[model samples]
Target: MTKERVLRFGRAQHLIGVAGLPAAPAPTGSVGIIVLNAGMVYRVGPFRLHVEITRRLNACGYPTLRFDLSTLGDSGASNESQSRAQQIRADVADAMSLLASHAGCTRFVLLGLCSGAQNAHIVAVDEPRVAGAIFLDGYAYRTLGFHLRHYLPRLHSAALWHRFISRKLQAAANQRGDDVFAVSFPPRDQVRRELTDMLDRGLRLHFIYSGGVTRYFNHPRQFRECFGRLASRPEISACQFEGTDHTYALQVDRQRLLQEVEGWLQRNFPTSDGSTA
Candidate 1:
C-alpha cells in the first residue's frame, strides 16, 4: 500500500509538498526521490504526472516527495534577494534536508521537466547527496543530424512549403531584422563538462525528451550528438518519445513515460532483491 501526506517546510520560506510512503520496506541503501515543479505548474506536475509517478515509485518501495519551490504552488514567496538560480538550488537543498530528517534518507534522486529539468541538473551538480537525476525534455542542442531529420520530412509536405513561403513573405513585409527565434539552451561544452564531473561522482543521470520540443530537439541521437563522447558513458541514459508532447498529454504517452522511468530506476538503482529502488 502507498500512503500520501501533505506537508510544508522550508529554511528561508515555507513550501508545500506531498510525501508518498510505501507500506513495504525499502531496500538497504535505498535513496528517497523528490519531484520538482515544472515551470509555473504546481507540484502535482503537468496533468498530475508527479502525483502518479510518486505513487508508483512508492509502490516500488522508494519513498517520494513532490514539492513546490516557494511561490509556485501552495507555497509562499521567499523574501531573500538571491538570484533565481541560487534560490532554486537552496530550495532543492531544503527539500533534501527535510526528507532526510523525516524519512532517514540521506541520498535522493531528483526529477523534473522542462525548466525544472534545468534546476535538477544544477542541483545534481552542486549537491553530493543527489544519487540520481531524471531530466525530462531538458537541455538540448541541435546538431547536423537533427537539422537533416527535421527538414527532410517537411520538405515533401506542400503545406510546409506554403507555410514557409507565407512566413517569409510576412517577414519581408514587416522588414524585421535577422529573424532569430529566442530559445535558450545551455552551452554545449559547459554541460558536457558538468555531466562528466557528475558521472565521476557516481551520479546516475537519465534524460527523456519528447516531440513537444521539436523546435530544439527531434531525434534520440541529438543528445549524444550534442554532448559528444559523454553520451556514451555507462552512467548516462537518454530516451526520446518522439510521438509524445512535452507534458505527455495523452494517457498512453504518460504511461509509457512512467514505464520508461521506472525501468531506468530499477536498472540503475535496483534493490537488493532486484526490484526497483
Candidate 2:
C-alpha cells in the first residue's frame, strides 16, 4: 500500500502537488519521479495518467510527485519576474527540492507528455539531480523519410488527390491559419546539442511518440533519422505506439503505456542491487 499527501511548496506556497510515498523505504540510489502537467492539463495528467503513474511507482518503492506548475491546475499564480519557460523550470526545480526534503531523494526521474514532455527535457538538461527523463509525444521534426512515407501512399489515390486539391483551393480562398495548438520546440540543432550533452553526462532519456503527431513523426526509426549518430548512443532510447493518439484516450492504450513505463523503469532504474521492484 502507498500513502499520498497533498503538498504546498515553492515561494509563497504557490505550488500544489500530491506526493505518493512508498510503503517501504526506497532503495539506495533510487531516483524520485516527478510527473509534470501535460500541456494545459492539470497535474493529474490527461485521463489521470499522472495519478496512475505515481501510484505504480509508489507501489514499486519509488517516491512519485504529480504537481501543477504555477498558475495551472490547483497551483496559485507566481509573482516571479521571469519568462514562462523560466517559471516552469523554477517550478520543477522546486518540486524536486520538496521531494528531496520529504522523501530523502537525491536523484530524480522526470516524466511528462506533450508540453510537459518539453518541460522535462529543459529541466533535465540543466538540473544535475535529474538522472533520467521520459518524454511522451515529445519533440519531433520532419525528415525526408517522413515525407516519403506520409505522401507516397496518397499519390496513388485519385480521390485523395482531389480532396487534397480541394483543400488547397479552400485554404487559399480562406487564407486562414491552421487550427493547431501554439506549441514551440527549440530548433532541431539546439535539441540535438542538448540531447548530445545529456547523453554525454550518462543521463537516461526515453522518447515515446504516439500516432497523434504523425504529421511530424511517423515511423519508429524517425528519431534516429532526425538526429543521426547522436540517436545511436546507448543512453538514448525511443519508441512509438502507432495505435494510440497523443492523449492515450482509450483504456487499452493507456494500459499499454503503463506497462511500457513499468518495464522501462524496471530495466533502467532497478530498485535493488540486481532486481527491480
Candidate 3:
C-alpha cells in the first residue's frame, strides 16, 4: 500500500492511496483501477467501509487508489465556497489527472459507494477515459430514488433503511418545516433520471446489490430500466446478495462480495485481475 499526501486542485491536501497490489510489476505506467469512497463527511462509518474494501480489493490482487473528494476528506477545493457539484466533479477530475501524472494511469475504472457512485457517474459521463464503473450499494439509480429508497419495504422487507429514514423524517420534522425539507433538495427520483442521462458512451456499469431491495425503492428491475434509458451502448447489470444491508461493505458479506468484484475486474480490467495485461 502506498499513500501520498499530494496536492490536488486548489492546493488542498489529499491522502491519495494505492493499496493491495502484490510486490510485483503492477502494470507499468497507467493504472488499472481507481476506487472511490462515498460520503466520508456524512458519517465516519464510511471510513471503515473504504478501508476494508480497499484492503480486500488489494488482497485480491487489485491495486486501487482510494481518494477523498473535495471538502469531504482530504482534498479541499481552491475556494471554500465551491458548490457540491463543482467540488465533486473537480475531485474526480483531479483523481484522473493524478493517475495520469503519477501512475501513468491513462484511463481509470471508477468505483464509488452511494454519493461517491453518483460523482463517479458524473465523471464517467464526461471523461471518455473511464472504461467502467461499479456502484457499491449505490443509491442514485433512477430506478431507486435518492438516499434511502432501497431501505423501503415493497422492495425488501423493512430491514435497515426504512427505520433509518423514519427516524430521519421525524428528525427533519422536529428540526424544521415540511416546506424547508421539501424544497431544500432535488427529488431523489430526478437524481436517477439526470444521472442515467449523463452516462458516458460504452461505459460498462456494474451495480452490485445485496440488501433485499426491490422496486418500491431501488430494485434490480428499476436499475436495469434506468441503465437502459441512459446508456446507448451501456453495459449495465444488477445482481443480488442475501442477508446484507445498505452499508454492505461494513458487515457486508465479505467473501462472496470480493468474488463478485473480482469477477467483475476480470471481465472489465483483466490485467488487474491477478493476471498480466
Candidate 4:
C-alpha cells in the first residue's frame, strides 16, 4: 500500500513540512534523505513521482523526507512574502538540520524545480548534510522571463489547496513563503554566482526539462544553452523531457522525471549509482 506519514513537523511562516515516512520501511542501518520542492509548492512534484523509488531505496535501507521549504506549500507564512530566494535556502537549511537531528537523517538528498533546484544547490553547499542533489529542469537564474506557471494551472492538484491554506492560515495568522511568488522581482546575479560556486563543488545534479515547456525557453536548444551556463561545472548531468513546461507538465507520469535523476542519485550514493559522478 502507498502511504505517507509525518515524522516531525515545522514551519517557515508560509511553508511547513513533516519529516516523512513512506508506507514501506527502510532497510536496517540505512539513513534517509529529504526532498524539497521548487517554488514552495507541495511535496508532490518530481518528489511524489519517485516516492516508490525512494520507498525501495528505503526498503533497501535508505529513508527519505519530502517536504515544503517555506511559503511554497505548508511550510511557512502566506502574507509574509517568504519567496525571497535567500529565505527559501534558509528554510531548506532548517529542514536539513531537523532531518539530521530529529529524524536521524544525516545524509541529505535534495531536488528542486527551476528556482527551487537552484536554491537547493545553495543549501547543499551551505549545509554539510546534503550529499547528493537533483535539479529537475533547472534554468539559469534570470532577472526576467515569462513565468507562465505563476498564472497557469501547473501547481499540481488544486482540490486540497484551499483547505490546506485555510487550516495553515488559522494556525499562523499569516504565511511566509507565498509572497516570494506573489510579486515578481529582478534577479540578483550574486545569487547566480553563489549557485554557480555551489555547482563547482561537484554536487550530484540532474537537470530535466519537459518537451511541452521547451517552447518557453525559445525551444529546448536555447534552454539547454542557458542551463549549461548555470551548471558550467563539469560534474553535472542534465537532460530534457518531451512534454513538460516550467512546472513539469508530465513530470508525475510513470516516473518520467525521476528516471532522469536515478543515475545522479546513485552515483552520489554508492547504491543509487547511475551514469553520474
Q: Rate the local accuracy (lDDT) of all candidates.
A: 0.85, 0.86, 0.56, 0.53
Model 1, C-alpha of 17: deviation from truth (Å): 0.4
Give a tens-digit lDDT track for model 4, residues 162-219. Answer: 7557756874875655543232323545645555655666455556665533334423
* Per-structure clash totals for the candidates: 0, 0, 6, 37
lDDT preference between candidates 2 and 3, better one: 2
lDDT of 2 by residue, 1-277 (tens): 7889899999769999998877776666778999988888888988888888889778777898999999999999889789987898889889988888777788899999988888899898888899999999888799999999879989799997897789679868976565333377889999999989988888998998988888699999899999999888888899999968888989899888888887888788887765543
Worst 10 residues of 2 by lDDT: 174-183
Clashes of 2: 0
Which residue pairs show collisions in model 3? 20-58, 30-104, 30-105, 31-105, 142-192, 248-252
lDDT of 1 by residue, 107-159 (tens): 89999998788889989887989999999988888899989987897879999
Worst 10 residues of 4 by lDDT: 142-151
Best of the candidates, lDDT: 2
Q: How far is candidate 4 from the true structure (C-alpha RMSD, Å)?
A: 10.4
What ranges in model 4 sit over 4 Å off? 1-4, 11-32, 46-60, 76-83, 141-192, 216-224, 227-233, 245-252, 272-277
* lDDT of each residue in 1-277, candidate 3, tens digit only: 4443334432454434443343443564334566665555431225365556556655544555666665556554456566777766666676666656554556577877655666676677667677778876655334435234443443565655676678679867787442211112246566556455434355577877666333233445555455455533436666766567555544537567767877876766666544532
Q: Which candidate is the best by TM-score?
A: 2
For candidate 2, the TM-score is: 0.91
- The global Cα lDDT (0 to 1) of model 1 is 0.85
Q: List the residue pairs that clash in candidate 2.
A: none
What's the TM-score of every candidate structure? Answer: 0.90, 0.91, 0.67, 0.60
